[model samples]
Target: MKVLVTGAAGFIGFYVSKVLLNKGHDVVGLDNINGYYDVNLKYARLHELGINKEAASNYNNVCKSTYSSHFTFVKMNLEDRSELPKLFETETFDVVCNLAAQAGVRYSLENPETYVDSNMVGFLNILECCRNYGVKHLVYASSSSVYGLNKKIPFSTDDAVDHPISLYAATKKSNELMAYTYSHLFKFPTTGLRFFTVYGPWGRPDMAMFLFTDAILKNQSIKVFNHGNMERDFTYIDDIVEGVVRIIEKPTTERVQNNELYKLYNIGNNNSVKLLDFIKEIETNLKMEAKKDMLPMQPGDVERTWANVDALIKDYGYRPNTSIKEGVKRFIDWFKMYYT
Candidate 1:
C-alpha cells in the first residue's frame, strides 16, 4: 500500500518509515523539520532513511530515498494549507499515519501557540485532506498524557479522558475527537494509538532516556522528578512500530463505539517501571553513577502511567516484551556512538 507518514523525520516517525520501507510498501514521508529540539538530529534521521540532506532541504517536492526505491520524503508542514491539500490530491495515499506534532508536556507550558498550530490546526488539515481525497485508513499518534489526573491504575481506552492537564494533551485529545467526527461523517476508518513513554535507539533528545544518558555521560545531575516517585510504561520503539503496522493493515470496518468506524488503543508496555529503577538501568548500562537532583514534580506532569493494552493484545496480538534494562542498554549504546 502507498502510505504518507507525517513527521517522518521524528523519533517514532523515522523508525516507522524504515519499517514500512523494509516491508516493501511505498512510503512518502513528510516533516517540516522544525527546530523543536535539534534540526541536525532530524536531518540525520532523514539521512539514515536514504534521504540526502541537500535534496531534502527543499519543501513541496518529493525526494526519493537511495536506501529503498519504495521510500520518498517531503519537507513540508501539515499547517501549509495550499501545499498540504495539493499533496493529498496528487499522491492519493491509501493509508495516512499522522505522527507529526509539537510534542512535549513541559515545553507546552513555554510555547502554547506551537501546540495550537501543529497539533490542532495541523490535524484539522489532515482530516480535511483524508476526507476529500478518499483515503481509506487514518492512524494517528495520541498520547498517554490524555489520561491526565485520572486515578485509574492501568489506563484503558474505555476510561474517560475528559481532563487533560497540559495544552499538549488537550490537543491530542482534540485530535481523537476530530478524527471521530471525520470517521462518522465520511465513513473512513480512523484509529488513535495513545502511546506510552516510548524509548529505544534513535530516541528523541528531549526524552528521559536520552536526557538521562546525556547528563550522566557529561557528568551532569539528572533531575529526578516528584522526588524519585514515578512510574512509566516505557514501550520499545520496535514494538510500537509493529503495533502501528498491524493496525494500519487492519482498519476498523465494524463500528465499535458512538457508531463510528473509529478505535483507540494504548500502545505501550503493560509493565510500569519505577522512575529510580529506570534511572538505575541507565546507570548500570553506562557503568557509572548519576549525580541525582531530586526535585518536585513539574506542572503538567503525571506521577504514574500504566497502560492496559489488553484490547490491543486481544485484537492484534500486540505484546510489548522489551524490559527496561535491555531497552536502556540499547539506547545508551546508540547514544554513545551518536554523541562521540
Candidate 2:
C-alpha cells in the first residue's frame, strides 16, 4: 500500500517510515524540519532514510530516497493550506499515518500557538484531505498525556480523558474528536493510538531517556523531577513500530467498536518503571554516576503513567515486552555512537 507518514523525520515517525519501507510499501515522508529541538537531528534522520539533506531542507520539494526506491521525503508543514491539499490530491494515498505534531508537555506552557497551529489546525487539514481524497484508513498518533492528572493506576481507553493538564494534551484529545467526527460523517476508518513514553535508539533529545543520558555523559547534573517520584510505561521503539504496522494494515473497518469506524487504543508497555530505576539503568549502561539535582515536578507534568493495553492485546495481539534495562542499554549505545 502507498502510505503518507507525516513528521517522517521525527523520532517515532522516522522509525515507522523505515519499517514501512522495509515491508515494501511505497512511502512518502513529510516534515517541515522545524527547529523545535535540533534541525540537524531531523536532517540526520532523513539522511538515514536516504533523503539528501540539502534537498529535504527545501520547503515543498519532494526528494526521492537514495536508500530505498519505495521511500520519498517532502519538506512541508501540516498547516500549509494550499500545498497540503495539492499533495493529497496528486498522491491519492491509500493510508495516512499522521504522526506529525508540535510535541512536548512542558514546552506547550511557553509556545501555546505552535500547538494550536500544528496539532489542531494541522490535524483539521489532514482530516479534510482524507475525506476529499477518498482515503481508506487514517491512523494518527495520540498521547498518554491525555489521561492528565487522573489517579487511575493503569490508564485504559475507557477512562475519562476530559481534563488534560496541558495544551499539548488538549490538542491531542481534540485530534481524536476531530477524527471521530470525520469517521462518523464520511464513513472513513480512523484509528488513534495513544502512545506511552516511547524510547529507544534515535529517541528525541527532549525526552527523559535522552536528556538523562546526555547529562550523565557530559558530566552535567541531571534533574530528578518530583524528587525521583515518577513512573512511566516506557515502550520500546521496535514494539511501537510493530504495533503501528499491524494497526495500519488492519484499519478500523476490520475491528468496528460501538458501531463507529473510529477506534482508540493504548500502545505501550503495560509495566511502569520508576523514574530513579530508569535513571539507574542509564548510569549502569554509561558506567558513570549522574550528578543529581533533585527538583520539584514542573507544571504540566504527571507523577505517573501506566497503560492498560488489554484492548490492543485482545484485538491485535499487541504485547510490548521490552524491559527498561534492555531498552536503556540500547539507547545508550546509540547515544554514544551518534554523539561521539
Candidate 3:
C-alpha cells in the first residue's frame, strides 16, 4: 500500500516511516521541518531515511530516499491548504498516518497560536484531503495529556477528557473530535492513538529522557519537575511504532451496517514509573550522578499518567513490554554516539 506519513521527520514519525518502508510499502513523508526543536536533529533523522539535508530544506519539493526505493519525502506543512490537496490528488494514498503537529505541552503555554495552526487547522486540512481523496484509513497521534486532572489510576478511552490543562492537550482532544466527525460523515475509518511518554533512541531533545541525559553528560543540573513527585507511562518508541503499524495495516471494521468506523485507543506501556526512578535509571546508565534541581510543578503539567491499553491489547494484541531500565540504556547509548 502507498502511505502518506505526515511529520515523517519527527521522532515517532521517523520510526514509523522506516518500519513501513522495511515492510516494502511505498511511503510519501511530509514535514515542514519547523524549528520547534533543533532543526539539525530533524535533518539528522531525515538523513537516516536517506534524505539529504539540503534537498529536504527545499519547500514543496519531493526528495526520493537513497536508503529505500519505496520511501520519498516532501518538505511541506500540514496546514498548507493549497499544496496539501495537490499532494492528496496526486498520490491518492490508501492510508494516511497523521503524526505531524506542534508538539510539546510546555511550549504550547508560550506559543498558543502554533498549536492552533498545526494541531487544529492543520488536522482539518488532513481530514478534508482524506475525504476528497479515496483514503481508506486515517490514523492520527493523540496525547495522554488529554486525560487532564483525572484521578483515574489508569487513563482509559472510557474516561472523560473534557478538562485539558494546556492548549496542546486541548488541540489533541479537538483532533479526536474532528476525526470522529470526518469518519461519521464521510464513511472512512479513523483511529486516534493517545500516546504516553514515549522515549527511546533518537527521542526529542525536550523530553525528560533526552534532557536528563544531556545535562548529566554535560555536568549540568537537571530540573526535576513536581519536586520529584511525578509519574509517567514511559512507552518506548519501538512499541509505539508497532501499535501504529498494526492499526495502519488493519483499518477498523464496521460493526453495524453503516456505522462510522472511528476508534480511540491509549497506546502506552500500561505502567507508570516515578520521575525520580526514571532519573535514577539514567544515572545508572551513564554512571554519573546528576546535579538535581527539584523544582515545583509547572503550569500545564500533570502529576501522573498511566494508560489502560486493554482495548489495544484486545483488538490488536498490542503490548508495550519495554522496561524503563532497558529503554533508558538504549537511549543513553544513542545519546553518547550522537553527541560525542
TM-scores for candidates 1 onward, in order: 0.97, 0.98, 0.98
* Model 1 lDDT tens row, 86-107: 9999888999999999999999
Candidate 3's error at 101, in angstroms? 0.4
lDDT of 3 by residue, 122-144 (tens): 99999999999988889999999
lDDT (Cα, 0-100) at 315 in candidate 2: 85
Give candidate 1 misplaced runs (Cα > 4 Å): 251-260
lDDT of 3: 0.93
Positional deviation of residue 298's Cα in model 1 after best superposition, in angstroms: 0.1
TM-score of 1: 0.97
Clashes of 1: 0
Off by over 4 Å in 3: 251-260
Task: For residues 138-158, write the lDDT of model 2, one tens digit per residue.
Answer: 999999999999998899999
Candidate 1 structure lDDT: 0.92
